[model samples]
Target: MDSEESRCFSGYDGNRFKLVILASQRAHELSSGAATMVDRQGDKNTVVALREIASNQLDLSTVFGLAVQRCRKYLEEFAGSRGIAGHSSHVSPSRSSRHTGLGKSFVDNKSTYSASFLDQDKFLSGGKDDGIKGF
Candidate 1:
């Protein structure tokens, strides 16, 4: 697979199959066979983890807890923005009376071109051949 696809697969946090595909792609790009072997091991670990999560062998809370722990680690490593944990209680404005803009102004419509056909013809011709020369 392409590098973009591999990156996307690596970024996937949802499924184990996706992770395996991504890891495989990365493994394939390795110059040394040793790196490929290491990737295979990682892929196997991901598969095992996925199976444990899927077969009810692992508790849902435990899975979520692990995910949260990993997310915390990532957050600490990246020092990125944290997510909100509580529900919002703020009142929303009524949809019908919602303010759109400050005010409306009546714009006067005007035509820049002259209405006379002769003026239009002259303007269009650039004062060159005025159709007098027969083809």
Candidate 2:
């Protein structure tokens, strides 16, 4: 029977794919009837440790992929819960200010626009060769 410490040590490998496989195997063995109850309990501990190792091994890209997947799944459920169709969250052209001239305030520069909008507005302002036009 593997000690709890040994199971934990087995998960310290730098490769996450191997850790996930190890965890899955442990989980299966723990849930199976082949081991004594005490050994099974130890396997369960190993399984948990392996899962933690797998999660820790995930790089930023992998984490981001998982986050995006989760967001897509839950966003549909969230929309449905709010009495809206999941697919109805489309980006409507009418809802965008680009075509509506709602961005005019920032472009005209009569009032100071927030810094976040300054860069895009500057591009829309045409070349610096043109003098500042008042609203």
Candidate 3:
């Protein structure tokens, strides 16, 4: 599990330091009642946040703010080389919780990720509850 988790730290161009900072910020958001951008999968907020970044399931702008513009050059190059128009969005577990009352399991057969969960503007302006911070 350590190896798997370590691989997640490389998601941000192998800059583990930056990845850690971003994950912590994302975890703070989760702990503050903001919906997750990815399935929780029984992991704590920190772990889930790490996995989200590792999988490119997160929009970098959400955590890094204006700093993301500087990083986008690399990402755009990587995406272009791989023929990816953009990162694919992942399903958040919140929708499933509505049907099963079990936030960790995927209960809805036709579940879709909420756009609100991926709102890039929320980090700086505060999230749905106005309690989440940008950094």
lDDT of 1 by residue, 62-117 (tens): 33434335444553443223221221122133522364321111011112112222
Model 2: ten consecutive residues of lowest lDDT: 110-119
User: On a 0 to 1 TM-score scale, where does candidate 3 land against the true structure?
Assistant: 0.42
* Candidate numbers sorted by lDDT from highest down: 3, 2, 1
lDDT of 2 at 105: 39
What's the ranking of the predictions by TM-score, best on top?
A: 3, 1, 2
Higher-TM-score candidate among 1 and 2?
Answer: 1
Lowest summed lDDT across 10 adjacent residues in model 3 is found at 103-112
Error of 3 at 76 (Å): 34
User: What's the lDDT for residue 37 in model 1?
Assistant: 25
Candidate 2 lDDT over residue span 83-132, tens digit each:
44323244355654455554343333423233232233332334452223
Query: What is the alpha-carbon lDDT for the whole of candidate 3?
Result: 0.55
**Which ranges in model 2 have alpha carbons more than 4 Å from their true place?**
1-56, 85-135
lDDT: which candidate is best?
3
Off by over 4 Å in 3: 1-3, 10-12, 66-135
